[model samples]
Structures are given as C-alpha cells and as structure tokens.
Target chain A: MMKQKNVNKRHLRNDILLIIVLLLVAATGAAYLFLFRGFGDVVKVTVDGELYGVYSLSQDRTEDISTGEDGRQLNRLVIREGKAFIQTATCPDGICAAHRAIFRNGESIVCLPHGVVVTVTTAQTQGEPDVVV
Target chain B: MRNKSKTTAFMGLFTALALILAYVEVLLPPLFASLPGIKMGLPNIILVFLLYRRSACSAIVVSLLRIALVTMLFGNVMALLYSLAGGILSLVVMILLRRWNVLSTVGVSVAGGVAHNVGQILMAMLLLETAELGFYLVVLTVAGTLAGVFVGLCGSALIRKIPANFLFLDK
Candidate 1:
C-alpha cells in the first residue's frame, strides 16, 4: 500500500510539474505577442556597408535594396524612424521576416547565415531592453 | 525467422503511415496565425506504437527514417534537423516516462508531444540565432497540449490492438 501511495504521489507531482512548464511556456508567448509588439519606432537601412534606406515608423513606407549583377552579396540593415527591421539579405532562411521590429536599445536584426545585422541602440523606455541579443 | 519478417513489415508500415500523416497535417490550416512551426504532430502516433510494441532502437530508426524521407520529398534539409531534434527528445522523454509505469499511454504520449515541441523550439533558436524566438514557445506549448492529447488517445487505441506476442518478440 505504501509503495502504491508513493507512486501515486510521484505521478501527481509530475503532472503538476508538467502543468507548470506548460503554463510558463504559454505565458512567455503571450507576453511577447501582447506586451512587446509595439516597443520601438526608429527606422534605419543599410546594405553591404552602404546605407540602403531609412524611414519613420510614424510614416508608412517600404524600401527595397537590390544586389548588383556582379553576384556580390549585399549586407543591409533598415531602421524605420525609431523602429528597426531587416532591410536586405541574400541568405536562405529569411527568418528576419519573423523578428519583431526594434524600437529600443539592444534590439537587432541579424542574418547569421548571411552575416548581416541591423541594431537599434537607443532606449526610449526605462524597462528591460526590447530585443534578445 | 517468420516472426522477424512480420515485425519488420509492421515497422515499415507504421513508418509509412507516419509519413502520410505528416503530409496530411502539413496541408491543414495553421493552428495559430502567429506561430509558424506549431504542428499537430500526428506522426508521433507511430512513435508511441513503436515504443510500446517494438524495441527502442526500432522506434529511433523509424523516427529518423520518416523524418529523412519526408523532408527529402517535400521539405528542406533544415526541416529534417528540426524533426530529428524533436524526435530524439520526445523518444528520450517517453523512455524515461515508461519507467515509472504510473503514466498511462496517454500520459506518455502527451509527454512525448511536449518534449517534441520544446526540442523544435530549441533547434529554431539555434538556426535563427536569436533567443527572442523563444517567445514562440508559448504558442508551441499550447499546440503541444492539444496535439499531445490527440496523439495520446490514438496511441492508446493502437496499443490495444497490438498482439502480446508481437510486442515481446526479440528477433
């Protein structure tokens, strides 16, 4: 009986732990989708050591950077007024499309496969920095 | 020898079943609009079945082969990496859970599904080179819960029909 009870207790404890982990995972996602969506507003764009385009988040506009026919890959970054996003890339993943726009200090857009990055370096808010480095 | 052939055939069938299920799930609508990698993980049913009826080595082989074959046919090699990570992690978690005997088939299946999601997210972080991607974990976990329950139920039903002799065979 004692062994059975112990097993039951262990099972219960594991169930509780699973629930806690699930909640933690859910909470982290909610915090990002809700709280961190609008934390920046500056726009800067650079490509292959050259400035591509800069815009204002307050203003709505899109900038395009094109690679030359020489097949030389271009490095690019875009900071929109106060929000920063990936301005250009030649890498395959295109994961930058998923990055949150950077509006505060420490926010950056990096293409690891392409070795390109766009960083936001000003803190408009006094809380934790927006992007994960 | 005949028994060994039968087991091999069964394993192949299950692997094929998993591949078909994966393709079907991919064609379905997204579970959440913001989450790109959230999957129902229906293919995990085959893993659960192999766990209960076959050796761990067989389960691993089926998992790896299914991932490799499916990715080669319809997806990128990068996707194969994510599936490999998810499959290995989930298999380990299930193996550990199997030891307690306290977990029902459903419970073990749920654990595997959750582990799979966690593993995929970790791989995504490394591939993307951004920890900010961790934000997707929440969505993946919720999706995992639903998928876990579904796969768990399917696993339990599958185990009910498997013969005891087939489960115990060692050839």
Candidate 2:
C-alpha cells in the first residue's frame, strides 16, 4: 500500500510538470507570434501554389476566385476596411468562409478542399513573384 | 476462448462509444468561433481509457478503426488524411507516455492532444504548400491543451468506474 501511494504521488507530480511545460511552451510561442506581428497592407491570394492575385487591403472590393478546370469551384474573397476574409465559398466544409477576418502580417484563411489560401502580408516582404506577363 | 471473445466485444463497444462521441462533437457548434478547427477531442477520452486499461496495440487498432469509420461516415479524403496524421501522432505520444508510467491518464492525454494538433498543422502546411499556416499553431496549441485537460479528466473518471477484469471473463 505504501509503494502504491508513492507511485501515485510521483505520477501526480509528473502530470503537473508535463502540463506546466506544455502550457509554458504554448504561451511563449503565442506571445512571440502575437506581440511581434505587424498590421498588413496587402492581401495575397494563391491557388494551388500559383499566384492568383495581390490586392491592396485599402481597396474595398470582392474578387471571384474560381479554381479547378472549367472554373467550377469558387471562393468569394472580400477585402474591406483593411481586413480580408472569405465572404463565401463553394467548398463542402465552408471553414474558410466561417474563419474570422485577418489583417495582421502572416495571418491567413485557407480552404483546403478548394486549394485556396489568402494571406495578409506587408508590402516589403511579400514572396511569390508578381504574375506579370 | 471466452476471454478472447470478451476482449473483442469490449473493443467493439469502445469503438462504438468513440464514434458516438465524435458524432456528438459534430452536432455541437464550434467551441470557439474564431478557432475554426478547435474540437473537444471527446473521442480522445476513450483513447486514453483504452491506453491505460488495455495494451497499446489495442488502443492503436481502436484509434485507426475509429478514424476510418468516421471518415467513411461523415468526412472526405482530405479529412481522412488529417485525421490519420493527428490520430497516429497522438496515439504514439500517449503510448510512449503511458509506458513511461511517470504521468497518469491526464498527463498522457494532454500530451496526446497537443501532439494531435501539431500533426494536423504539419499536414496542413504540407498539403497547402504554405509555411505561414504554422502561425495557426500558437492558438491551436492553447486550444489543444484545454481540450486535453477536459478529455483527460473524463478519461480518468472512466478508468476509475470501469474495472480491468471487466473486459475479460475468468475461467
């Protein structure tokens, strides 16, 4: 009985230690990501790794993003008040549509089924070459 | 022979329970509106229980079975991939933690939950071809931790209520 009690105590301590460690890691990461993030000026949309478009967040407009052959899939991206979000999507899950607007640098809304991703980025550090023919 | 059949029956019952829990979670609205992918990890409660009561092999088999059945019933191919990644990673973490015997069900489940989110996020990064998706992990980790604690509490309670020998018949 004494041994069992000791083992239980050890397990309890381990549990607390593990939880505290995980929480600490998460909190630190969050602090870094949130505190250092900057407001974005442009919304970058990509479809299947290809540059779809780069729209100024300052412009309030809706763009019809049609993907897939014959343009069957569609995700309506709306940029307004310097925030970007998917107003509507034809994807099954509709997760991206439900996602909250993103205006901070590196924030994104992803539609996995449609292979659509909209990211907010500052003007200086935007990757993916501008599609200029 | 009887014990073998009893074990099989128990496994089946556990699978059914996990499926019911998954369905229940689906029926409920998203836990956090801002966090689209956050879930209660309700099925994980059974996973933790099985890990403690039965062998890791049984728990793995049950986890895979539950994911497969859930995919066929309500999810698509993409969902299948995500579930497989998360389920396998979480199960592996839980198994190792349980084997170490340092932490009890709650700790094991907590690690499992965090690992699950990490696996899913990794898979998302790969499939979406976007490294920026990793940004979601900061918030996702917090959600995973909370879900882990809740599921862990339920799992420990379940472990206490259910006896080890209940799944096997004594000759």
Candidate 3:
C-alpha cells in the first residue's frame, strides 16, 4: 500500500459538503424510521403464505418453525424478554435472522427464500382480515 | 514516467490487499457479522482509494477479482451472490460520483458505501419475496453512512500519500 502524504485543498470543500449531505440524509432517515415504528403485542409466524403459528410476545419460548414442502426446519423463532426474533434460519439470505427483535405492533421479520413472515400485531387486529370476510 | 511492470505490480498488490481485507472481515468474530445490516466495510477503503488515485477500470477489475477470490477461498454461493451484487453496485456509484468531480472521496465513498448496503438489501428482498425488508433499510442506511465515513477517512489518508502517477489516471 502506498503512503498517504499531504491533504488536498480543493477536495476539502467537497468532502465537507459530502459529509453535510450524508449527515442530513441520515438525520432525515432516522426521523422517518422512528416516525413509523410499530407497537404490536402478538407475534404471528406465517409460512409459505399461510398461517403457521401465533404466539404471545409476553411469553418466553423457543419455537422451531418448519417451512416449505419438505417441512425441514428452517427458522427458529425465539420469544424472550417481551420481544420476538429469529434465533436461526436455514434460508439463503438469513434476512430473518438479521432482523432485530420485534415487540411493537406492525413490526415484522421476513425470511424471503422460505416464504416465512414473522409479524407483531395487536390482539384486536389479529385475524381481522379473515374474520371480516 | 510509469512502467508497465510497476502498474501491473500495483494492480496485483491492490488485489491482494483487497483479498486480505475481505478475509479478515469474515474472520472478525461476530460483532457486525451477527447484526445483519451492519458492516465495517473495511475492504471498501481500497476500492475508494483506487477509484481516486488509480483508474476506474482497474478499480473495478480489482474489486471483482477480490470478491471472486474471497468468495472462492472462504464464502459460499449465497455469499458470492451477495458480494457480487454489493461490490458491483458500490463500484458503479463510486465511479459515477467520482466522474462528476463535484464530490470528494468522502462523498464518493459514502455513496458507494450506502449503495453496497442498498444492493444487498434489494437482493435479500428479492430472495425473500417481501417488502418488510424496507424496514431494515433505515438501520442499514445509518450503518452504511457511518461505515462510509470510516472508509472515507482511511481512503483519503491513504490516497493522499500515494505519488501521483498519471498512467491509468488519464481519462
């Protein structure tokens, strides 16, 4: 690796401008994220577009959620300390595993490859769509 | 004033540096690794350095070669796909921003850093067939921006020291 010598003068202005832009973007983005944060009480796990299981986030347990036709174990949904998260997933992306814990209503963790959707919902809105129909 | 052999040697050295960085990142325990959307983006420093000091084509080649070599040495198929998607997207953005010449390496690296995360998230969304990943981008954007700053500092410091050789830089 070549050594870095002195700093450039013109690049400084642009660098500062870039930093400003990035800080602004990050600030607005943080606001947007906080603005729409959820508050669900129930944790719902769905597999392959169908309802697989529903558990209360208030309780603590380890659930092995099997997905797809073969029913091979793909995700491990863990509920503890009043939050829900995927302890593990055998899927390709592991997006579900990467997700932070969810406890608020409307928060969800999705495993794309296995078609698993773990969502947090209020007791009132739970199954409202099917029941309304 | 530039020798072909020296240029070749620089290219090889950059490629090796990138490979080492990538490998080290993978073996760095699980702090950022377990966090999903969060990454240090240490390897990006070299890419940004090359983009500013060297030619974009060589930078691209080095970036792709680094990804391929790293994936082959220590990653799986999914990792390969993710690296490819992220590396290409990041390089493209950095090249464009650098060409604009309005932004500094910091800005270019920031764009590149954020683009890498965005690309990976998009690929994840496609594989998962869900938009909930959108929620994750908020965190990712923040993480990416911070990582970009770190990479920018390193790249800026390094690029500033390198002797100016206009061989491949002529564009």
Which candidate should be chosen as best, given TM-score against the real structure?
2
| Model 3 bad stretches (over 4 Å) | A1-14, A46-61, A67-73, A88-100, A110-117, A122-133, B1-9, B29-37, B165-171
Worst 10 residues of 2 chain B by lDDT: B162-171
Clashing pairs for model 3 are A3-B161, A4-B161, A5-B160, A5-B161, A39-A104, A39-A105, A40-A104, A40-A105, A112-B128
Rank order (by TM-score, best first): 2, 3, 1
**Candidate 2 residue runs with Cα over 4 Å from true position:** A127-129, B1-4, B169-171
Whole-model Cα lDDT of every candidate shown, in order: 0.66, 0.86, 0.76
Candidate 1 versus the native: TM-score?
Answer: 0.68
Among these predicted structures, which one has the highest lDDT? 2
What DockQ was computed for model 2?
0.70
For every candidate, C-alpha RMSD to the true structure in Å: 6.3, 2.1, 5.1
lDDT of 2 by residue, B7-81 (tens): 778779989999999999999999888778689999999888878777787788789999999999999998999
Residue-level lDDT tens digits of model 1 in B1-171:
357777688778878988999999879976765444467888888888878776677778888889888988876666677878888999999888876676766777778888898897687667655455444466567777778878888987888876666644444
How far in Å is the alpha carbon of B29 misplaced in model 3?
4.3
- Candidate 2 local lDDT, A76-116, one digit each (tens): 99989999999999999889999999998888999988888
Candidates sorted on DockQ, descending: 2, 3, 1
